[model samples]
Target: MTTPRKVTSLDVAKRAGVSRSAVSRVFTPGASVSDRTATKVREAANALGYRPNVLARAMLTGKSKIIGLVVAYLDNHFYPTVLELLSEALEREGYHVLVFMAAHTAHDIEDVVGQILDYQVDGLVLASVALSSDLANRCRASGVPVVLFNRKLEAEGELAVVSDNRSGGRMAADHLVSLGRTRIGHIAGWDGASTQRDREAGFVEGLHAAGLGMFAREVGDFRLPRAKAAARRMFDTSDRPDAVFVANDYMAFGVMDVLRAELGLRVPEDVAVVGFDDVPSAAWPAYDLTTIRQDAEAMVTITVSSLLAEIGGSNVTPPDPLPVRLVRRGTA
Candidate 1:
């Protein structure tokens, strides 16, 4: 059996008795074409079973209408929600997303970004991933717009959209202090992340303002198993903390589980727990974890708008970090 020849736009144009350019304009989004020409092109395309080749048009227009998304990991519920929102927003804008997985390290991200750039993506969004200065320069030279979501770079003028993590941390600390919990402890996330750094800094500043120091501290590295182990170590002692601030909701769930299950500690009575990122699970009755809300929808909106603006030849400034508010629940 022989393979059939693929129908091209020329075939449709010949059948419609219209210029090839008219058929192209009809398929091109936002392109102006007369109603009569469009009707003829549609009828001919249906008869010939000819579909406009997006990649072929991209070669002519120099716009792939594709956005490359690089993510470190999606173990945290917050990231998955953001990913879904970003995908939806881009789809509505007539763009497609090409997702790439990479480790959080600079080297790994650099390698992954190199691969993404090769696809001629119109823009790049780094979610929970950082881009190095060298890689940033290369992307700039290539004229590809880059946006950091839930992440940031030390370099100036990089576009990023994220929740106000520092303020959220301070709010958590204030809430715990107002409850008259003096022996406040903290479960830290990965030391390398900007979110972890800013959140911890604000929490420490709040503690200092109250004339208190951390009763105990342990590094969870943003993993559930590590958080559980850290909880065990923090609570096993007779001189345990009366309250704890967990870095993120994902780790908080583990800390809460270990507190109630392994250590048999009563929450908010024996020890108050506060967490960041009010993920859906945090509101569940089982945990009812009081946390800092990140406003994922707001962040997604800003990220998508900023990225598209940059892609449209607009010089975009990084927007102010989205505001976060304290969510009260049974945990705290």
Candidate 2:
């Protein structure tokens, strides 16, 4: 069968007994058109099954109504939730999300971002990835609004939305210490992530304030296998910690699994555990992990609002970091 002919605005205008310009105005957002005329145009377009060409319209209006989202990985439970929230928020604002998964390397990010730019997205949100200085400068020069979500760049003049990781770290340390856990250890996330650095610093500071020090530390690189290996090394030692804090829930789950299944240790009894990013799994019957909540709702709301403002030329300065809270549960 042959494809049906495409319907055009002129056909709708003719059928609605109005000028083509009137139909164009009716289809364009924020364009001046009377309610009666818009209704007529809509009825005519429906009858003819005429859909406006979005690309052509974007060319005319100089706005794609598209937001590019760059994420390195979605395996982490926290990031998938954040991505869903961002998509919902952007949709509510009449924008579409174009997601790009970049590789771990800086060059990969730069290439992917360059491809995103080719689509002329209205704005960009970088999640859990940092852009190179050259790419950042290119984005700035292009005048496209760029916002970092759950990540921060050392370069000045870039917008970011993140949880107060330092405070969360301190809160975790304080809770473990309050339980009289003198030999407290830490399982850190990826070394290069800003979240990892801040959390570690705050935990160290909290331990010092309590007149104690870290009994042991290991890098998990935000992976489950590495975290399990770290747990094994820590627990197999003669000076095994009485308590431990894992940087995020993903790694926390691994540490907990090893403690219970492999090491035959009970949580909060043999080894009290605290984690970050109070992900949904943390509250499961299996883990029930006490953790620092990153306020996903608040983080997503601020990120969308900030990115929209930058896109609309209303705000340029980045907002302050949002606060985190300790969520009490069975663990620790």
Candidate 3:
């Protein structure tokens, strides 16, 4: 069988009795086009069964109209929320998102980013992951801007949008202390994560300021099973904590399940619990978890705007970390 030739923009322009540039501008997002010209082009395109070749246009215009997003994992409810918000926000600006998952290791992240660069994406966003200096430099050399969402780097000049985690930690600690819950324990996330380190540091600071010390500490590695195990170990002893501050809501749920279901303890009666990241599930009746709100909407807004700004050849100053607030519920 013989193959039919593919319809092209030139065919649409000829059929519309308009210049080829008119058809190009009509198809190009954000390009100037008169209403009459656009209508004619659309009608002609429909008759000819024509669509603009995005890859060819990208090669010519040097813009893929795509943003690459790298995330460590979406197991946490918070990340999925951020992803959805980010996709919506980017789509509003005529850009599409290309998502990739990578291990938390620097080498793995570097490999994932290298692959993203191969697609000629207009910009990059990293969530719950870090970018190596070498990879950062490579992205810069390629004129691809990067924005870190819900994460930060020790190295300066990298753009990031993160909640005030340290303050939130202190808020959790202060709340526990205000309730007269002494011997407060802490369940930490992956220590390598900046959120974990900052939250723990602030919690410890708050405890010291109140003339108290951490009664117990356990690392959960931000995994549900690990959090449950840590809870078991922390509460098994007779001299257990009366209150606990979990790093994030995802781990908080695991800890709560272990405490009530497995350990047969009444929440807030036997052990008051506080968590960070007021994720949607925190408000569920079953958990009713008190937590620090991370402002995912605000973070997503800043991330998309900052990335678009940098992509537009404008230098961007990293915004100050946004504030977090404590939300009281049955858990605490």
- TM-scores, all models, native as reference: 0.93, 0.92, 0.94
In candidate 1, what are the lDDT values of residues 294-323, reduced to their tens digit?
999999899899999999999988899889
Q: How many pairs of residues collide in each model? A: 0, 0, 0
**Poorly placed runs, candidate 1 (over 4 Å):** 1-5, 47-49
TM-score of 2: 0.92
Off by over 4 Å in 2: 17-19
- List per-prediction Cα lDDT, in the order shown: 0.92, 0.90, 0.93
lDDT for 69 in candidate 2 is: 96
lDDT of 2 at 286: 89
Candidate 2 structure quality by residue, lDDT tens digits, 290-328: 999999999889888888888888856777888999999
Q: Candidate 3: how many backbone clashes? A: 0
Model 3 stretches with alpha carbons more than 4 Å out: 1-6, 17-21, 30-36
Question: Model 1 compared with the native: what TM-score?
Answer: 0.93
- Candidate 3, residue 28: CA error in Å? 1.6
Q: Candidate 1 at 219: error in angstroms? A: 1.6
Q: Evaluate model 2: give its lDDT.
A: 0.90
Model 1, residue 206: distance off in Å is: 0.7
